[model samples]
Target: MRDTLDNLYTLDTLATFTPGVFYQFLMTKTQQFRFVKLGERFSSICGLPVAALLHDASLLFNCMTAEQRDELICDILHSSQHLTEFYGCIALTKPDGKQIWLEARSSPEAMPDGDIVWTGFVYDVTAREQALAQLAKSSELSRTILDNMLDSVVSINEQGIVIYANQTALSLFGYQAEELVGKNVSCLMGAHHASQHDQYLQHYANTKEQRIIGSNRVVQAKHKDNSLIPVELRICELDNAHGRSYLGVMRDLSHKLMQQQAIDQLTLQDALTALPNRTALNRRINQCIDNLALNPTQYCLICLDADDFKLINEGYGFEHGDEFLRQCARVLSDFGLYFLARTGEDEFAVLLETSEGRPSLEQQLGLIVQALAKPQQVFGDLISCNFTAGAFCFSTADFTYSDVVRSAELALHYAKSGGKGRIAFYDHRLDQHQRQHALLDQYLRTPDILSQFYLVYQPQYDVAGHLLGFEALMRWRHQEQAIAPDVFIPLAERNGAIFMLGKWLLQQACQFIRQAQKIPALAHCRVSLNISARQFASAHFTDEVLTEIRRSGITHSLLHLELTERLLLENPKDVVAKMQLLNRCGITFSLDDFGTGYSSLAYLKQLPLHELKIDKSFVRDLPVNSSDRSIVSAILLMAGGLDLEVIAEGVETELHRQSLQQLGCRRFQGYLYGQPMRAEHWLQH
Candidate 1:
């Protein structure tokens, strides 16, 4: 201990000694340092210039790091009895150069004058430090493995504190390495998960539950700002020399979720209007029915369709029809309907919530009808919606959802059959209407209905009371009632039964001419048969007529085919050619209902027409209705210019006949001339 205290001498005592040519400085019997080594390497490593050290060796003593110098003193002062030696490593810098480690030793040097100085030995250990650095660079592969991983890599010690985090983990949680290291790993979890994380670790430590060790899990992770995000998590047990720790990998799922949502939108939406498609609407119906168990929500399923939409589709191409539907979707969307969809080619459906305080279902339907009344201008064509809607209301009482929708469909058919352009609510009476359609379908398919079909003729006469011919009118006498010609005729046309009925009518007309040929009074008279537009357009029409003529052996001149002006105007070139072909073979065509159709004089001269029959509507009110007089005068003058023979029908009074005669109509047919009668009754007359 005396030697140790003697080696720690002050700078003043070292100054009193003579400066030595040998590499040595002195120290007193105190723990104060003064460099005695004057070698260039020792002076440089001790961080003092050669001149500064020579001028005052204490400069080298002050240049030593505080930690290294204090450690040296502590080692000397705490030594055992009689031990003054000390040896250890210390670090220092020369000027602003790099740190250089030193292996230094000092011992007491007792002089004869009772002053003492330390004999110090110091050397540079920079090579040893560099070898340690090279050892660390050799393990760089481990760092590269962690950095290149897509999943975030995190390591937590047995105490649940984070000890290591890779670049991916730093980026995933939005934190720097220093900010995350040493913090509890639970900081990376949501609050709910964080609360239980400690318990999880404790249980795993005690019970060794390996539930999370090797399995992947979907979980939420907290970012640095505490916002939670979804992540796919995987954890593995890591056992190493330091202690127990955990390594976790996490992958983000935000972009994947966004892509799935985009795909779902495309699947469930209409391509044009972005409305829910038929599939989604079907799902929505079931969902609404499920909600009915809780609330008393009154709902209605409505079926609506455009009237005469086929006409529009044919008039303007289908592309325009598609644009019309898209526009209709826009209009219906603005109604705030509970649901809407384009359910058919030109039909739509809407689900409405008829809750209390809202408008009644009827009123809501009326509002839509009124809105449809406004013309929809599309592609410079002003088109009115002209829609017919049918609704079936339902509450919780309805058991099956599909049945209610079917009931609405039945109501829609009833609305259209009752003369469309109206809304019809589902009532019990519509059940009877459905039955009747079924019955009609059965009747049309059966062969027995043909026997009940027959024709009656209404005679045509000139003003002089001479018989010209008779118009053949077909009628159906049903088992229960006499069905109106207007009702049964459209039914036959709609069901494709018109073609058969038309052929039968022509045969009967030709048979009548054959029978009437037996009587001299009816031999040369003509027979006018009204032809349906469907039948007139048939390719077998001219053949049917000539075949009937040869079968009955009646002159083809006696059979006159009556067709409407509108039918003549449709495909005028075709109709004209067909009429001219038959007209050349002694068959004549009479233009039926002349003024009521497309009555332009441009097509008047083009048709091979033998007569023009003024519509009965104009003939009903004759002389007193001067408007009818003016209309009749115009028709007569146009017919005169075109050399078309004009005949007036519905002549119920002598005044009508006289008035028609004054308008230059020489032929007339109505009850005034003769009521429709059997060919036998006509022959007897």
Candidate 2:
């Protein structure tokens, strides 16, 4: 009995100091409320003494409102009948009028007397209750704001389950707000992205590494109809009551992307031809250059232009010219090359992936050139147009986009300038050739260019070592730089400057012939000068030669005009007419480089030619090469039958001279006799 009293005293001591009120109560079978026990702090918490509470538990109800009193009685009755736990939170006013919140939790037991006894505690939870009410109000406000936002907002749990989606998000994804609340976030994603989304979340959870969070990304979102919508999404990590979640704010990007693509198309295409323009070609070239490092492959850039396109513009109108260009673009497109673009007014550029090597590429290019030559329809007229192309091939990574384009353009220039309707390939040698051509073109355009030119005389001799005549060779000196006849003459002929230069050559040679006539021994010696195809083809050529000879007052028979076999290759009738006109006036004609070019006996027999000059190639090997010897013999025999004089050129040694004599050649012009020298030097010698 003493130990039991000691335990009761220990329990009373523990309850008095404990926070709030600890109590035990009961409801009798007769439905009478009674207090079993109450803590000393019940007075401090409920404004009632512990003994007063134990005597009548109704005294504790006095601290609560009338509603609280009724609720407490009903709970007591229900707990007695059901023997269930009793829990309640109620607002109370103390005797001093201090307002507070009280929370109670209790477990009831059925007594042997059919009464239910309760053991529980009630605590003042005013601060926590107020805070929770405020939080609920704030949450309602936040939800209202998110639902009305222009941008879609969504919240997902760490496991990627959609916990919350605002009205805008539901609309953007074509879903109702309730439909999206419990679904996995991947439902709004395409198959590929959906398959990997779980793995991405799992990786983030394991590593805490951020790949998409805290950064805005452009991604494709799937709508309810299975159509893809572009979206700009920003994901943020949110720490909430449910552990880590993600809040994604997204904006639709579909319209903006479409607008940008329209702008890019305008910037990268030709307005008239409807083909990719220079800017687009440049961009593609840069992309190719960038990829060359990763994948090494050959690239061939063909810069081509419609040959004689200006005639189309002149013959037809500019509108027709434009239509022709468009038609040309279509035909080139049909060739099915890698890339095509309009680079100039009548020019187009094609980029070829040259995996098939240069020969096959060339063959393909040849077919394109040929196909373009077949007539195309432009404004109801079947106009045939030809294309001249210049191509540059490269596999090295060191070339820039501009370098490749410029090289191809250089090849194009070479092709067009050489003669239209052909394809030219660019090489290192061609690069050097173009540089020289540009410099020569600049110099040749000068006003005083004729003053820079002069003639050298290479003596032509007989078998008796007597001077038969002199071949007047043209040379140029541009401020101490010597330009060879083979170099500047072709450039001059193509540029139409050969007319001026040819007139000067004729005047100079005629004057030399006049000077020779003053010397009795050299008076009969014929002076030979070369005639270019351009010069020979001139309508005024026959008159020009007759006028030069007449103005010189020298014997017309003493002047010999040298023609190449290339002249006979075209317009034989015109060539014969020009030769016959000059021959009738006592001027002679010799076929220069006879065996080296289009040697047709048909055209050879029709010409009024006096001599044939054996090109150095056939004479270089002399007796050493049997084929060359045989070729030289054949040429000599052919010349003999035609009653034409044969002069062996490039005779440098006694063996060469002796071999030509054995072949029945009487005349020769070579370094063995004398090299070409200035007119004054030859006169003094």
Question: Deviation in angstroms for 100 in model 1?
Answer: 75
Reference-based TM-score, model 1:
0.56
The runs of at least 3 residues in candidate 2 whose Cα sits more than 4 Å from the true structure, single-residue gaps closed, are: 1-226, 230-283, 292-398, 408-429
Total backbone clashes of candidate 2, pairs 3 or more residues apart or in separate chains: 1
Count of clashes in candidate 1: 4
Tens-place lDDT per residue, model 2, 642-685, is 99999988988889999999989999999999998888886654
Model 1: lowest-lDDT 10 consecutive positions: 13-22
lDDT of each: 0.74, 0.81
Stretches off by above 4 angstroms in model 1 are 1-268, 282-298, 306-324, 355-388, 394-396, 399-403, 410-431, 621-630, 653-664
Question: Distance (Å) between predicted and true CA of 322, model 1?
Answer: 4.7
- Candidate 2 at 381: error in angstroms? 26
Cα lDDT of candidate 1 equals 0.74
